[model samples]
Target chain A: AAGVIQSPRHLIKEKRETATLKCYPIPRHDTVYWYQQGPGQDPQFLISFYEKMQSDKGSIPDRFSAQQFSDYHSELNMSSLELGDSALYFCASSRMGPVNSPLHFGNGTRLTVT
Target chain B: SQQGEEDPQALSIQEGENATMNCSYKTSINNLQWYRQNSGRGLVHLILIRSNEREKHSGRLRVTLDTSKKSSSLLITASRAADTASYFCATDAHAGNMLTFGGGTRLMVKP
Candidate 1:
């Protein structure tokens, strides 16, 4: 089975720079969720989209924005990046109807701020 | 806000011993799920128990939910070094599909 795919397994950026992370969800999955996990910390919900429309928002920062494309893939963009933004960015996908369904996760992108 | 809170932030045990972790949440939820992450990798779904269900089992894993107390427990029987990882309990509340995760319990099984 095809799992969620995240690009740029590792990313390095400097302060005040911009970065874009992309996600390709599993086929037929209509919901995409983004999460950020800092070192030695639990994953934090960032934002989510259902069928290309933003459905829920979490602790995502103002400098960060995300959107799901017509093909069900999603992208998270961060600007004016800060050192605190360095973390493992994960993308998960699930079917929209059953909220209890399991979420398929990608390996995630490791963002490092220099 | 984070929902589930797990106990014993870290646990260490010998191989073949059983490992158990507990989780408590604040609000009512539609379901609770257990996930495992090795080091810095992505999370892998272990098992899920619905709100109305009391207990569920998969392979060597057992999950129990007590909606009354808003708590849940996960037990891994006959543990192995391979099971060494961080375990987290996540809850999806009646509010929406977004899952609120716990602080996670780090388990280290010795060989």
Candidate 2:
């Protein structure tokens, strides 16, 4: 099966404009997560979804929101984007098995808020 | 907040040499996992060690976890140029499935 897929591989938007990024996790995977990576930095958690519910929210600003639909697709929305929003957004998925399951990630969407 | 701290922010080694990286974390954890990310790419799972286990091995990778000290170490045996990447350690807290990752250590394997 194809790995996780994210939309708008690269996006350039003017500040204050709204931007939405979409993701489709691997088929049969029940858990999905979103993470942000700044230049020369490690990935930081944004939020997580499991079984179509928001399992956890990370240290993101209120402008960021996410939704899990039917346990397959998840979308991350940013309103009134600021220059700080420029970074790589990654979508990850994993099957609910042993708690030791490792997350499988997509290539990620590069969003640049100019 | 995350519970782990990785040491030696960066390491440079010859392709045939060994590379060892260390991590220390606060609080008890269900498990600790290691990941590798190539430049501008998503992270790839490397190995995992449970709280109850002391050491685990996969192919050429060796991982050791010390619950008493709340520390872990990753050793890459006979590294290759392709092994150059940023390595991170993540902790799965005893109470949840979410993983809290540590600051990564970038490794450069000189060919």
Candidate 3:
């Protein structure tokens, strides 16, 4: 089975720079979720999209924005990046109809802000 | 904010032993899920127990949920070295599809 795919498995950036991460959800899955995990910390919900629309927001910073395209792929754009932005960014996908469906996650993109 | 917190920050057990991890949450939830993550990797969903269900099982994994106490437990029977990883419990509130994750319990299964 095809799993969720995240682009730029590893990214390095400097302070005040910008970075864009992409996610390709599994086929037929309509919901996309983004999470950030700092070293030795639990994953934190950043944002989510359902059917190409922003559905929910969590602790995402103001400098970060995300959107789901018509094809069901999503992109997370971070601007004016700070060193604290360094973490593993994960993307998960699931079907929107039934509740309790397990989320399928991608390997994630490691962002290192220098 | 995180809604769940796992007890016993870390555990070390030999292979073939049964390992149990406990989680406590703060609010009402429609369902609770368990996930495992190998070092520096993505999370792998293990099992999910709905609010109405008390217990569930999948392969060598068993999950029990007590809605009244706002707590859940995950047990891995006959654990193997491959099971060494961090386990997290996530809660889905009635509000949305978003999940609030717990701090997680690190389990090291020795061969």
Best by TM-score: 3
Q: After superposition, how far is residue A98 of candidate 1 from its true place, in Å?
A: 3.8
lDDT of 1 by residue, A1-114 (tens): 899999989999999999999999999999999999999888999999988999999999999999999999999999999999999999999997744588889999999988
Give the candidates in order of DockQ, highest first: 1, 3, 2
Docking quality (DockQ) of candidate 1: 0.72
Clashing pairs in 3: none
Q: What digit string (tens of lDDT, one per residue) describes model 1 on residues B1-111? A: 277579879999999999999999999889999999999899999999989999999999999999999999999999999999999999987445788889999999999
User: Total clashing residue pairs per candidate?
Assistant: 0, 0, 0
- For each candidate, what's the DockQ? 0.72, 0.55, 0.71
By summed lDDT, the worst window of 10 consecutive residues in model 1 chain B runs over B92-101
Model 2: fraction of native contacts: 0.40
Residue by residue across B2-54, what tens digits does model 2's lDDT show?
66678888999999999999999997899999999988888888887889999
CAPRI class of candidate 2? medium
**Preferred candidate (TM-score higher): 1 or 2:** 1
Worst window of 10 by summed lDDT in candidate 2 chain A: A94-103
CAPRI quality level assigned to candidate 3 from its DockQ score = medium
* Candidate maximizing DockQ: 1
Instruction: Say which prediction, candidate 2 or candidate 3, comes out ahead on DockQ.
Output: 3
In model 3, which runs have C-alpha deviations exceeding 4 angstroms? none
